[model samples]
Target: MRLRRDHLIDLRPLTTSPAFARMWVGSTLAGLGGQLTIVAIMLHMYDLTASTFAVAMIAVAGLVPMIVAGLYGGMLADAFDRRRVALVAASITFASTAVLMILTWSGGETVAWLYAIAVVNSAANSVVMAARQAIVPRLIPRELLPAASALGGITMGIMVSVGPAAAGLLVAFTGYGWTYTIDLVLMSALFLGLWSLPSIRPEGAVVRPGLRSLADGWRFIRGAKNTRLQFILDIVAMTFGQPTALFPAIGAVLLGGGAITTGLLTAAIAVGAFFSSLFSGPIARYPLHGRGIERAIIAYGISIALFGAVLLAATFGLLAPDRIGEDSANIGLIALAAVALAGSGAADNVSSIYRNTMVQAAVPDAIRGRLQGLFIVVVAGGPRLGALYAGTLATVTALWFPPLLGGFVIVGLVALLVRLAPAFRAYDAARPTP
Candidate 1:
């Protein structure tokens, strides 16, 4: 019984903080809706363009706006009430999604409209995410930060897993209109969560959102070696390791089963995250968060490399069907690839738990929003860069080559970066320092 208890996720944060619980529930539901829209958009673009590069460009298009919003949103979070900032951002997201739904229903959604709306959605979401993340440390106790982060993993797991799969099925059967409509309905939950929260102004010297504020945040980060190192490590891992941009093509040509395959491949990562968070009790007890982050990311790189190997095997006619297309699939290879992706997801979640806890515990409240904003940029921007990298490389080379080569690049780069930053590897959770 004790062993079982030790291995289970802690529930105290939810039971102890009703406000956090309400917010978590709202975020989870709203996140599921967000995923629906994201996957739907990808599928919509692919159907219209039939170009993998075009599909990848969706994320790329939003990169600049998302970065700007994240940084400025962080400053807003610091200067204004976090709850209000989040609410305003959520409102923007809701309105944009409504526009998407209306356009799809009216048969007026061109590729250009889709791209523009996606940029708006992504930009607004960055602000919402920056504010929401900054709010977590204030709501929960310091000791429960890891558990809270694990719970966040669970939210992500459900959102990505169920949302993608559902979006695919909806787009396949009900068409894009229904998918967008469902997302529109789910976005309402975010308002509930944000509206229920009390006003949470920054606890320290607040910095207004602008050039001077960004400079101050940058100065703080420059002095905070451990925090800075974690950002670099995350960038390295994400830049080389992300292969999501290739999923659409992989499903169509390499793996088969079409939209279903894409959805399954994407959802597999969340499946791993969900289970990892479900059994995260032991993870919270580990003191060396720095070491944990390093080891987990290394494992993530290995898993991604293995996924590449699975794709490579498919190319060699290993466990492959004679004719692969939307109607048929290489189940064996798909399963292997899903397992590899799931492993990567689990490892990434573990790294996130440590990184989030470190940041929340180490950074002061006054600067926490700005720092988290920067973190959001790295978090969101890294994947955008990864999409461009994978998409361009795959366009020139082969589908399997990007993850295969990029995985090793991540492994080597992360190792070198960590070795040089002794302070990051030596970070102790008990005595948190930025």
Candidate 2:
């Protein structure tokens, strides 16, 4: 089991393309800031309303706008200079975040204000994400895509791991205004990154950004069976397996230790993602992306189920405290839950690496933006839907029930869908066919 030097994350992508390197660094920093705001908002919402459903609503509220932005942004990326498209989208994100910071400092922050700002931020970010992803294939050789994606996992790992933990500590000691201010400061790096990039217009036939472009992208997707199936697989895994909406409550009531526990729970997943990418050399060379995705997602589902089992055990008073509260925690149960979550994170990252590589290498550059737009939508939107599912289910049943049931559902549905899509199962990286 000893991993060799080459059996680790390849850093060639950074050296191969300076543009990609700068963008990666900037995006990583900005992503960290974004995570801070995301976790803080959730904690803030829970603090104000003390309702998990209210916290979940923050995501649900932004879903439609995000979807619209993603689709339109993709078209814009395909038709115009991608650098310009990304810059415009980044500006909107920066403005929305500034407003959020201002409201927090002015003591004018209300639930309604948070929701509205969140909606704006989410929509803007979807565009930024679509443009950014669409820009990736143009920056590096196709063979380097898997390595680039593994690098992205590292970026996400740092963002989630450091960001949430820092948010909790900052909110606990320094207050909400300072946390928002820090995020606003970090966001400036994104502008630098996007500003320095050279103009990149889409290759091949270009269609203007409009209804016709949308229909064109749709037509391409209809024929891209592998791409379509991967999207469906991702939706199934995320919708049923995500249990993030319950973190605040889980920390307060189930695991105890309040904001700190919530941060720890959130960070554990990213920790696993980080380590998985750290050792992803073999994964980058793997040719069977479709099968890799299937197997990885199945493992993800199992890990989620294990997490649910841990929560169920806590419910049964196994290694739990007689009296659990914000200050008092069942440390053992918390540890077990973190381990399960970490497993889920690692598995999910593996799945993401395969999925991303497939899309980037297989899809045509002319239409890449539009497909990536749909990709980003599914990635972002699925979690929102999962939050709704988790929040509602937890509200009706118990904190432990949602993940417990949802995990099995993810396993069953993903397996069934893959079985039905033989082409996906046979997908080969050497000759990618979308």
Candidate 3:
């Protein structure tokens, strides 16, 4: 294969690895559909309960199960054929979503039923995510891991941006049934993606799936200082920094325009992620990845802080309703929110690119799947826990306080963590001695 320099980055996995490209296509489609159902379910529950706390609990309910599945699923990836493991996980995800859709379709949908099914879906998705992450490095070369990761971020942004906004429109226009059915159709594409990948099995001693395997993976993670520090830093950032749970309150109270504004703000973050990744050639050229992750997450903290500052401004009436995107959103505030979200997205994506590269390049292939499984767990579960935290805190206090305060916490915590662990800070991409 020929290498071409395009912009700041020189590698192009999309053109080189046909298998990776196919997987990306299939995953992207299914992800879009998944988002639609996720948004619809949250909205449906919110409408039924009229309680943001309840909406937050939907995430909370799924957290423990997801964590469990993620841990166990990593073992599965290490023990058996990864493709088969992924297919089984996907099957569970698909079946639960199908159940969710059918119940909503049958007109007997209850909040209790939605909660039950969402927990199942989220847990299964966690396993699929762990399996899929382990599968990606196998499909592409090491040199292109960052680009592949950036592309993954772009995929995430697009799926989240379009799906929820589309879900909102569909639910508002055609009811929840049609919106959910789209996910069912999209999910079928996932099977094709998994089926096409080469059969990937564990490289080293394949321990049977059990507590012993989980402990072995944890030990591996601990011994890898760079990997361990990065995980710790990321956890601190994600655990305290994520502001997604505040969207509903921001729409109704702080930002206005109800669900539409909420969707726009949510989509706005993805817009930032998508654009940032699009121009990621510069970021990919960075020599020091460990330092890059530290800085990017720090930048993310500032951006999220900006988001909170905007809300605080709105609360104090310093920023009027026009920008909030209500029946009368001040165009200036709308622009400001979008800017904040975009900046946050860019910083978060950069951090993700580096973190992903760190794990893929540093970890060995034998334990790689197991390690990646833990990575997936952190990636998927941290935000949900943050949601629970934000939601509970906001329920007790105020919406603006959560993000506003969370931002500062992320900034201080990440800086302290990075300073203490020089290994993560010293992670050089070119020398790459992870």
Candidate 4:
């Protein structure tokens, strides 16, 4: 097959808009810190309780507050200046991180303190993310939105790939206090991005931030079949296929690289996403976005199953497990698992590019904040739900069973949903319909 020339990332958004570049850089740095904290928190929980279910409860603890914050934050973004909204939300996150750092340093950090702080941090971040996502369209043109989304993937890619690995190393070598303190320091970078942005409010008929505004947003979702389908499909994919909560256990028990293994497994997905976004020119040019999303998600499910298979092999002693606190590496199985995760990451990033493009292109700015809020809730909250699923199911069964079975469930469900929603399957990027 002849290689396509337009497979490279487009840098126009970065070069054409200095403001976007600044925000992107600042967001990227802050996101990196955020990922560091996420991984660190998971590791910390596992250390404290030595139970996967306990670690999974971190997501459970934060889920409801995150959803509420996402909804209200979207309303705030629509009603107020998005930049200022983001700044305020970011300040909350920064303060929470600072408190976490202080607690860790004091050597008095308990599981309760961690969970409480994480819950607050998750809620605050929902607001920051809603405002940040809503502000993007105003910064760049509609046509460039896909490219911008690809750039956003790159941000996630770098953040997830580097941040987790760094957190693992930091926590493993320097201890938890230093790791949190580093995140606290890194969070300060977010201010640079928000500070440089000009005021951006909703451009059309404005709705006041309240229950009425939220109901209107929900009404829009009910009417927007394509947008709603994408959300549903994403939730299904994440709910079934995400195996993040299993990583710490996998690293410690099955895979055997301990913190390094956990970090590597988590980072593998980001590596795939980063590379896919790095070479997203073909994705940007694709017109039939719905089909693209469906195909990518199927591929994602397949990769997830493959990962489960690798884990199953390890369970069967087909691969060697590393000893605890030792440098013993299960090179073959780790490589296989990483390869599978990398495939899933690339597919998910492609799906996200199309889904994000659709929302930004088709959705009206009047209620874009709320829709994006819902989008954030789906995107961020789905994984938390997945954590609950994977954690609970794995606790009851085995790590490999959940993903192995869940992968097929994702493929079957997504195919069924597409069959039910012809409009969604027929969606075209060039002519967005929401």
Candidate 5:
């Protein structure tokens, strides 16, 4: 296929709005730092407790609080200036990272302290994320939303690809204190992004940030069939398809390269996301967003199933038994697993592009913050649930079983949901309607 320049990631958003560009750069850097802290916390928890379950608990602990913060933060974005709301959220994250660094540097780090700080950080970051997403639509035209989302994907791709790799190395060479310190330093970029933006209060009738306001957002969502379906579809995709928490175990028991394998597996997904965004010209041109999301999620489910198949193959003695240990690596199985993960990553990014575009285009500006808050909750919460699902299932059955079964579940459930939502299947980007 002959690729045209327009098929690539459109850079119009960057040139059109300097504020958006600065925010994009700042958000990207800050996000990279956030990833560092996330990976570091997991490694730190594992070191402190020496248990994978304990590490998993870190995410589980933060899930509820994060949901709360996302909802409240979205309200705040709608009520006050979005710039201020984002700055406040970013400050909270900065302070949390600083505290984390201090604890590590002063030799006062403990499992409880780690858990407490991590939960706080997660809650704060969710707010920042919601505010940021809400702000993007304000900065660019509706037609350019897909491009902006693709840019977001590139930012996420870089963060995930580099941050974890950096975390592993920094932890190995410098120590946890230095690693945390680096994140604290990198977070300064976020201030620049938020500072450059103008005050952006939500248009239309503003409401107080309370249950009533939240209920109003819910009312809108309830009435908006296509929007509701997109949310449900995303949850289905994330809940059943996400298998991130199993990477360490997969690397140690199944793929046999320990941290290196885990890093590779994680980065492979990010690489796919990055490449997909880099060549997102084709993605941005597509107008049938509903069908696009449907097809993309199905592909995502298939890729996850393929990854499960690879793991199952390893269990069936496709790889040498002796090579199935941290000390002895199975290069071939690791390669296959990475390929499958990459495929999943690519498909998931495509779904996200369409889903985000639909939300930004269809929803009213007045309630966009609240809806975005709920969107953040679904996006953040679904993966945590998936992590729990994968970990529990793997512990109960075998490492290969969770993704294998979960993948099929995603495929089946998503198909059914899309079938039931006929309007979603007919959604057109040219005439976006909630």
Candidate 6:
């Protein structure tokens, strides 16, 4: 009930553990660098081929491979030492990035080469991500799960906010080579972070990596009523409601603000996440874990609806531009949408705290990595799928239409799902049985 600032902080698992703290520091920088490289790659690919579709394919090309990497990486984590798995994955990334930098600097600008290396980079990053996520619980107490997740939110907030912006400026001023070089340097920290940790072997029996393993994970998930429901619910919310892919169009047309609006909108969500984590560390220590998740998701839906309202208001011209400083591209509408977005970010952070704790606490350590790999697949792949949904709807309907519909659908769907899953509703925090 009483939400302390550290309650917010402690909501994340990484904050309570010193070792995780160090790892977070490294991962945060590396995450930012990775984002920089990602945006840079998109831009570079576009510059070479001048096809947005081709640029989109870069992610598509890597999608299956990334999923494979995540799944197989989980297998490796479960079967072998987590530290070694992470190190090997990180090494793959580091080496791939170095090659990217070399290619960029050597005046080789083949679109094919870009696509090839991008696949390598994305696949490696995905595996490294799965391995790192599985490694989190080993560093902290069970009570610190929320705190660790909050720390992850902070890391995500900063990296996602800062990385793209920096990459844009760097690419605009200097070149893509510089961006790739920065990534190479930043990736070194991940190696150190992972390499320094002691070997973290799985706590329970290990399964071989394949179809059987996937089936076992599914069986394990089926028995986990709360876990299964949460994942399904999240898939619904993320698949239907995620409108990040439509940001550029929202800014350019529906919102009528442009790239600055797009960038600001994206960054505002991250800012909210940063503050949410800052406040959530202690909030994570609440009495009602399951109910907390439900309330948070409902709040998230409300926030999303508010975002839709802002978009609709902009489209309808109810809010005057000149009065709200429309001269510099009507930042008033942008600010209003930002508030909604920020609220969404906060609510989502809260939900993440519960969801992550549920996943880590409910599952055994031996299966945690593999399960987390699947979780990573969900986490990583959801946005790309969202991109498809948003892009398709935006092309046919309107840019703002998807968000407008998405918000309402999320509210209705999540509410209904939460109601259906009574066990999740009764999930207790102190004796987390989810």
RMSD (CA, angstroms), candidate 2? 1.2
In model 3, the runs with Cα more than 4 Å from the true position are 1-11, 318-331
Per residue, candidate 2 scores C-alpha lDDT tens digits across 1-434 of 45687789999999999999999999999999998999999999999999999999999999999999999999998999999999998998889889989999999999998999899999989899889999999999999999999999999899999999999889888988999989988989998888888999999999999999999999999999999999998998888889999999998888888888888889989988998999999999999999999999888888888888988887888888788888789899899999998998999999999999888999999999999999999999999998999999999899888888888888888889989988889999999999
Clashes of 6: 25
Could you tell me every candidate's TM-score relative to the true structure? 0.99, 0.98, 0.94, 0.98, 0.96, 0.88
Q: lDDT: which is higher, 4 or 5?
A: 4
Clashing pairs in 1: none
Q: How many residue pairs clash in each candidate?
A: 0, 0, 5, 0, 2, 25
Q: Write the per-residue lDDT of candidate 6 for residues 338-387, one digit (tens) a residue.
A: 88888887777777778887888878887888778877777767656665
lDDT per residue (tens digit) for residues 289-317 in model 5: 99999999899899999989988988887
Question: Between prediction 3 and prediction 4, which has the larger lDDT?
Answer: 4
- Kindly report which residue stretches of model 1 are placed more than 4 angstroms away from their true locations once superposed: none
Off by over 4 Å in 2: 1-3
lDDT of each: 0.91, 0.91, 0.81, 0.91, 0.86, 0.75
Global local distance difference test of model 6: 0.75
Better of 1 and 3 by TM-score: 1
Candidate 2 weakest ten by summed lDDT? 1-10
